[model samples]
Each structure stands twice: as C-alpha cells, then as structure tokens.
Target chain A: MTQRDHQQKKMQIRDGFIAGSPIVMGYLPIALAYGVLAQQSGMSLMELTGMSLLVFAGAAQFMGANMIAFSASAIEIIVATFVLNFRHFVMSLSFVNQLKRIALPWKFSLTLGLTDETFSVSSIYRKQANQAYGQYFYGTLILVAYLSWVFGSLLGGLLGDVIPPQLSQSMGVALYAMFIGLLIPSVKKQHKIILISVTAMIVNYLLQPMIGEGWGIVAGTLVGGVAGIFVLDEEENT
Target chain B: MIWMIIIGMAVVTLIPRIIPAFIVDFVDFPNWVNKWLEAIPYAALGALIFPGIITVVPEQPLIGIVAGIVAIMCAWFRLHIMVVVLSAIATVFVLTL
Candidate 1:
C-alpha cells in the first residue's frame, strides 16, 4: 500500500483499540474473578492459562471449571461448554453480514476473538460507519480484549491467595452489573425488548434445574427471539 | 486428562463461531431473520443476568440486588461502562462490610 493508505490503516487500528477500551476495562474485574475462581477450584497456573487461551470464553470457562471440580467426565464438560456458547453462532452470522468483505484468513482469526462484548462494539461501529473497517481495525480490537482476558486470568491464578476473601467475593457482582449496563440502554429504546427479555429470564429460571442448565438458555432465546420478531413487526407497522 | 477436556471444549466451541462465517453468505437475509437475530442479544443477556444476580451473591442477595440497581441507573444515565462496573463492585464491597 501507499504511504497514505498505510497511515489511514494505522489510524483505523488505533480507533478500534480505543473503541474496545471499555470492553477491556469491563473484562478485567470479571476475568480476574474467573481466575480467582479457577484457582480456588484447584486449577494450576498453566492449566488456567491454557483454558483461557484455548477456550477464550468467560461463561463456559467458568462452567467448565465448576464441572471439573466435581470430577465430571470430559465429554460432559465439552458438551456443556459447547451448549453454553451456542449464542456465538448467531453472533457470527450477524457479524458476517457487516464484515462480508474481510479476507477469509482475517475473518477466521477475528471470529476466534468474537465475544458478546466485542461483537456489540464492532457491530455498533459498523452500523455508524458508511464502509467496512479494514483488517487492522478488528485485529486491534480483539487483541486488547484477548490480552485482558488472558492476563487477568493469569494474574488471578497467581495472586489469588493475596487478595482478601470478601473482596474477591465482591468481584463476582461486577460481571452481572456489567451485563445490566449493556442490556438496559437497549431495552429503553424498544419496550418489546423488555418483554422478550423478561420472558427469557422466567423461562431460564424455571427450566434450569430440570432440563439442564444450558438448554434453558437455548429454549429461552428461541422463544424470546421468535416472540420479538412478531412484536417488532407490529411496532414497525403502527 | 485435563488437557484433553480443554482441547475438546475448544474444538466444540470453535465450530459454532467459525463455521457460519466460513460458509454463510451475508446478503439476502430475510427481514424476519434479521429481527430474530437482533433479539438474541437482549434475551441472552437478560436470561444470563437476572437469575445470576440472586445466585452470584447468594450469601447476601440484597447486595447483588443493590449493585444491579446501581448498574441500571448508571447505564440509564449513559455513564461509562467502566464507571458503572466499578460503582457496582464498590456497592457490593461496602455492603459486605
């Protein structure tokens, strides 16, 4: 590329990193908690880093750690995590639409870093911009998020003993609060979001202990998403 | 043994995220399909958070509730996400003391 093109590309990558800063900030406390939890559950530092590196998924990694503590079978752990992360499939599809022009190798690498937060940040950026961002934009965004997650886990694993128990326990609340922060704004825009959300919450709560933890979420999302389609169409027509 | 489980989980999780991007064409999604896709984030976050609040601070459910409320207020006012998260964590910490 020309000098001007290279300059512009660097600028986009910087913007991507800046846009992803909040998510990295958000991931730190939560991932720290994950590290502490994984350590407390008897994961070695190497084991902890390996899981964070390979899995790179927060909820599933937490769940997998819990199952490991119970000495649950390997297949069970694999299947359970797979089910918990099924939402990524939907996210990838949505992202593919906006990122259609990205090269295949770059798209594959970026997809590996896709999380709920990264997807949200990238998609919001895509919608606001007239054109798709270059590969560097996504690369930097994912790079920051990935570093926070892995490093947070590593720190938690190594220093978990030094932190006081009450403080560590308090850290668990940070993630759920972050989720609320992400959810409420969107809910305010469309009232139907509330309906879809509440319905899913109720379904998940009721079904979790019976059918299996992961399936409850799956069932709830399907019901809520289907319900939202009808509600959104009605609102649009009115 | 642990390595095997870790690798297994990675492979399974990789499929859902990677396969669709590789094979699926972006154009020509029906409107209803887009609507359905749009709804996933709301419903997914809701389901994950609501039930988690009670359980996350099980010994002190009230702290979790307060933190969640504080988070919603911060988000509603359009505060930075980091501020919202830190404030909520502070609420829980102070409450537990």
Candidate 2:
C-alpha cells in the first residue's frame, strides 16, 4: 500500500474502533449478567466462558444454558443451538463480497466474530476499510467484547451477590434493549418489512407448540428475512 | 458437578469455531447468494427486537412491554440511541412501580 493507502487504511481502522466502542459499552453489562445467569442456571465457569468466546451470541448461550440446566441431552442442546444460531450461516454469507480479497484465515476469523453488533459496526465501515483491514478492525472489536464477556462471566460466577438481584434482573433486558437500538435505523418506510415481520411473529406464536424452538426460529427467520428482502427489492424497482 | 459439565461444553463449543478456521481458509460464495445474505442481518435484528419490545415484563410485565414499545418508537424516530434505551428502562420502572 502507498502512503495515502496506508493513511486511509489507518483511518478506517480508527473509525471501526470508534464506532464499535458504543456497542462494546452496551455489551459488557449484558455479557456479565449472562455469565452470572449461566452460573445461576448451574453452568460452570468453563461452559459460560466457552460460550462467550466460541458461541458468542448471548441469546443462544442463554437458551443453551437453560436447556443444560434442565438436563437436556447433548443432541437436544445441539439441535436447539443450531436452530437458535441458524441465522449465523446467513450472516457468514454476508461477508462473501467484502471478504473476497482477504486470505482464508481472515475470512474464517471474521466469520467466527460475526455477531449482530459486530456485523453492524464492521459492515458500516467495510467499504472504507477494505476486506483485510475490515477483518482486522472487526477482530479488534470481537477481542474487546469477548474479553468483557469472559471476564463478566468470571466476575458473576465468583462475585455473585456483589451485584444485586434487582440489578441482575434489570440487566437481563439489556440484550433485547440493544436489539432496539439496532432496529431503530431500519424500521423505515418499507411496509413489506413491517408486514413480513408481523407475519413471522404470528407464525412463531402459532407454531410454538408444533414446531418447537429450533424449527420455529429456523422457519420464521427465513420466511421473514426472505419476504422482507424480496418485497423491498420489488418496491425499489418501481 | 456443574464444573465438570462446563469443561465438557467447552470442548464441544470449540469444535465449531476451530473446524471452519482449519478447514476453510478462504470461502468463495457466489454473487447472487451474497445479495440475499445482505438482508439477513437487518431482518434478524428486526425479528429479535420486535418480540423483545412486545414481551410481558416480569414485575409489571404487561404494561412495561407496551410502554417500552411506545418509548422505543419515539426515541427511534428522534434518532436518539441513548434516549431510546433510557426511555425503555424508565418505562419498565414506571410500569412496575
């Protein structure tokens, strides 16, 4: 890279770090609570920390811990987790174009860190950062968030009562609340999006008994995602 | 007892992470497929956030959920990320109290 290229790359990295800080701030408390909740639900420190680093999605880990606490079989937990995380595969596909220039390690590592928050920050900066530097910046974001989550779990496991019950219950809403922060920018004039989402919610509520957790998320996410995607494309065409 | 189970889960969880890293150095997904994946993240966020805003809150779960949805809508339209969060928390607190 030339001097200008190098300077530009540095700027992109800085942007990623800056934009991602807000999300990291949002994530720390929730990750901490997830850790504590995992232990409370009978998960050992190792399991909770592993999910923080490996699985990395708070929602799935929360559900997984619930399943494990109930003494669900490995197969059931695996299937449940697979269903809960099926959207991840879809996310992996998102990086295909942007990641084409990077080496395989970067691609693979980027995929590992592709959580909702990470994707939002990284994708916003990808054009400026390019594939290689975008992955590096995103990795930095992941490392920070992952450390917070791991340490949070450790703290919660060891320092249980230091955090009040009222606070912990309140922190439980943080993840969902973060979802609100994310959804705000997108609930634009796309009526199909609104319609598709409402339909999926109804479908999920109706299918709660028959399809169960794994199938419900899988079917609902696809139906909703595809319907919203296609419908918007048609609207833009006109 | 839970510690032992945690150890076991740690091992299981690492497989998914390590497998793709080791086996697939670079992925080559087709362009058309890529187009669809672009929509997945926003759609997924939408689905997750919607139910969260509408769910029954625990203390005063019923009213909190409704109030939260309204608070979020106002803050969102105003483009204030912080206000959205604070309002939701305040709504829950008010509904419960």
The C-alpha lDDT values of all candidates are 0.78, 0.59
Candidate 2 residue-wise lDDT, A1-238, digit = tens: 7898687568656766666665665676677767767788877777677667656776677777787778887766666566656655554555444455566766676666666566655554455435435655666766666666667766766766576555445544555565566555555644355655565556555664697654554455566656665555532311
Give the per-residue lDDT digits (tens) of candidate 1, residues B1-97: 8889889999988888887677755456777877776676667777767677876668767778888889999989999877888888888889888
Could you say which candidate leads in lDDT?
1
What stretches of model 2 exceed 4 Å from their correct place? A1-6, A41-47, A67-76, A95-102, A120-132, A189-192, A234-238, B1-34, B59-64, B67-71
* Colliding pairs, model 2: A104-B25, B57-B61
> How accurately is candidate 2 docked according to DockQ?
0.34
RMSD to truth, every model: 3.2, 4.3
DockQ of each: 0.67, 0.34
TM-score of 2: 0.77
Docking class of 1: medium
Candidate 2 local lDDT, B8-36, one digit each (tens):
44444434443544433355544434444
